[model samples]
Target: MSVIAILVLDGLPGHHLTTPGLVFGTAAREHPGVAYEVRLCAGPGPLGIGLPAPLPIAVPHGLEDLADADVVLVPGHDGPRAQPPPGVVDALRGAAARGARIGAVGTGVFTLAATGLLDGRRATTGWRHTEELARLHPRIEVDPAGSVVTDGPFLTSAGIFGGMDVCLRLLAQDHGERTAGETSRELLTPLLRHADRVQEDIDRERAGSAGIEPTLRWLKARLHLPLTPADIAAHAGISVSSLNRRFRARAGVSPPRYLLRLRLDRARELLLDTDEPVERVAALSGFTSAASLRRHFSRQTGTTPRAYRARHRPATSPAG
Candidate 1:
């Protein structure tokens, strides 16, 4: 049984503020021996991070709480001026120095970065704030695609609910897969997301120009066809070279990759919805063959198409 401290600063999104209570409280129910001593800590002040009150509980402990914890969890907070609070930063620094694992949920990384703990560390935050985080801490590696990033004692998660994934990761590291899986069952965290799915969708949207958008709409319509980059470029009334440049500049990927991602997403949907064979699904997804589809799908999602389809297909109901 280890003590975990979850620091709640002022201005945290109400929903994000509640996630730790849900996850940790539920985890306590599922695993009796693996007790988690949870606390909501605040700095020394009556208003305490500008939280709305009638205060729920008097501040039991201040920054001193960090020193006794095995792990320190920081939830995203707003009104992070050019720097996070000095006392808050110092407590995190001291905790990390004493070998406590530090985890941040969402924009909470801002607080950790302010302490210089995240310098040169790999980290992530909400997708909307990835660039902002990178710009603020130029030395830190901000990975938009990663749900969690770990460098030494520091770990940071992407967004609000991503904290549960980080918690599961920590549990897996300390105990084992079974413990983490059981904890996940109790917490109900999303098991996994295809690594590039979100990025691919964003890439597709920003990759093309206004003229290219109409052509992309057409390409999506004909995803059943094995359309080439040259064909798409021609449809956009641009040379393949210019179209490639535009996509690279805007979305940071090539046209062909964008198209593949679109087809793959549709394939995933169809796999969930229909009982199509791998070869037929691949053809409809614009992949040249089943093996090719499996290769790319596994690369992107870490799961084979057949396995995913089998797991996701809905069980049929009998007519009443």
Candidate 2:
């Protein structure tokens, strides 16, 4: 069984404390041979969680427990910018030195950054605090766009329910995409939906209007179809040139670029969630052929479809 050490700090949100167990427990229950032991570790103090109604928690495990963990998770807290408690940073550094995969959820990235582990690495926090994180930690390349950013073994996620995304990602890495997808479905959490929501948030911010939302929805619904600029323009009741101008002004990309991104996202989801062949995945995601999917997937993600699947899925597992 993989041991997950969650470093609980004061001012922690309630969900951050619970999400890891919820996700991992579901995975273990649904899939045989997948097990995780989650331990809540903290520095010497009475830990108080910062929820709407604040609650104090008694964490039995101390910082030393971090050394024995396969994965260390840090969740967002209210006082993210504040320095971590005594011995917290050293404990985190020790865990990383010993080869534990560490992850930060939401503002928890600040705590991880405090240890200098995230220095010179790509990371992200809640969109609201991306600017602050970048300003504070100039050494860390803060990506404001990604819902989850993984640089080597250290992973950081955006704010709020980003913890779920991080845990799901951890599950996918440890077990396989099939286990992660099943667990996500069991929890009624769609794996790709959060990414889609993040993209929608970016679109709304760039477009500054709801006018493009309908078009985005239309494009997503018809991702399996060979959609053209003319089809998109007709759907929006505009000429191709007007559609291009509107997409550029509002969505910050041309219609073709935006559609390609959507198709890529769909292809990635299919690759992870299903056992469909590359050719079928390409057709399902609106790519013209397997070669088209391979070219675009490689350009965007830096890996071929088979390599991606092999890297993400366990070799011991049978292919469907």
Candidate 3:
């Protein structure tokens, strides 16, 4: 049995409090062999949750409950960048130091970032505050484009149903793809809607960027090419180090990491939109070989290329 502790804070969003339980509960119902205990912990106080109607709630567990948790999750509080109350950050730091996998959903990423555990680690938050998060915590590698980012043991997600994405990822990690896929199918409609909405948000964010937009357009046009960081730097007319710094500051990732993400996104699109063979898809996605594509895809997505294609392809499309 795995114990998952949620640190509830005052002014936390109501959905953020429920999302994890909903996911874990659904997973448990689907997989009886997997047992999980979810505990809501917080410092002693009346915690207020913000929903359409604000409500006051109380939890039985305290910060000590996190001591035994296998995973410590932070929910998004009401404020965009408010620090967690006294003792919360300390407890989170203690949990992380003890090897507990720490995750933050939505603005909760700000709370985790405030603990300094996410310093030098990749994280994302609500689309509205990605720049604010980056400005507040320059040491942390902020990834605005990803729906969910897992770096080391720290996981962060952009707001809205991005929390669901994180939970799906957690389910995949805890059980396997079979269980995660079943659970995903159960929530397919909402998940797809969430993906579309998040993509629109990301697209808007990118469209508003003046400096990085042209470079992004150029890179997207050439995603099929096996381009190196030096190639990108030369094309941008800047040193590799300068390119890295500019990308990290403006786009929230290094050039190579961003390129890899772009290629992966293209590969996913190809897998869904066309009945292309894995080898051909790999070639068009700038992967050197199908083997390499499969390796990286499985590592990043927790599913095989064939499974991903099968799962995502349109119903009218023939199986590849």
- Residue pairs with colliding backbones in model 2 are 126-159
lDDT of 1 by residue, 186-250 (tens): 65534335535775776667753334667768978998887888888888888999888776565
lDDT of each: 0.72, 0.84, 0.81
Off by over 4 Å in 1: 46-58, 189-320
| Maximum-lDDT candidate | 2
Order of candidate numbers by TM-score, starting with the best:
2, 3, 1
- The lDDT, on a scale of 0 to 1, for candidate 3 is 0.81
Query: What are the candidates' C-alpha RMSDs?
Result: 10.0, 6.4, 7.0
Error of 1 at 17 (Å): 3.4
Tens digit per residue, CA lDDT, model 2, 76-180: 887888888999999999999998989998889999999999897878888778889999999998866546777677889986778888899888877767778
Q: What is the total number of backbone clashes in candidate 2?
A: 1
Q: Give the Cα error of residue 318 in candidate 1, in Å.
A: 50
Candidate 3 local lDDT, 124-241, one digit each (tens): 8887788888999999878777578877678788877777788887877777656877887776767678878997887667546524667778999998888988888888777888
Judge candidate 1 at residue 316 and give its lDDT: 27
Q: Order candidates by lDDT, high to low.
A: 2, 3, 1
Which residue ranges in model 2 land beyond 4 Å of their true spot? Answer: 189-307, 312-320
